[model samples]
Target: REIERDALRARLRSHTGSRAELAAQLGISERSLYRKLRSLDRPD
Candidate 1:
């Protein structure tokens, strides 16, 4: 799950400009996408 978190963070970091678009393409809600990102940076 942590690896999944990292992957999503990297994707968000590298693809900053197109997040909402990418999130749309990925078939997930923007809020859900952001929640995944928070998980990566949050304290364990």
Candidate 2:
């Protein structure tokens, strides 16, 4: 999960599009993307 989160963060850093676009590219809703990010920030 940490590796996945790191990859997501890297992708976000390199992506120039809006969050919605990124979410669409990932096949997830914008809200789901935000939720995943928030969860990744929490201690496991």
Candidate 3:
């Protein structure tokens, strides 16, 4: 399943924890989170 970009952005904005922690909360790997963020930066 894919995560929504807006939801990801909202979580990132509100999150005060480290990337690893956020990844754990989202049930994804830290590397996956980074990839998602990177994809969000690119032109769809």
Q: Estimate each model's TM-score.
A: 0.64, 0.81, 0.90
Residue pairs with backbone overlap in model 3: none
Candidate 2 lDDT (Cα, 0 to 1): 0.91
Q: Give the lDDT ranking, best first.
A: 3, 2, 1
- Per-residue lDDT tens digits of candidate 2, residues 1-44? 88889989898999999999999998999999999989987999
Which parts of model 2 are misplaced by more than 4 Å?
none
All models: lDDT?
Answer: 0.77, 0.91, 0.92
Per-residue lDDT value at 3 in model 1: 81
* Root-mean-square deviation of every model: 1.8, 1.1, 2.1
What is the per-residue lDDT of model 3 for residues 1-44, given as tens digits with 9 covering 90 to 100?
24599899999999999999999999999999999989888877
Candidate 2 minimal-lDDT segment of 10 residues: 1-10
CA shift of 27, model 1, Å: 2.1
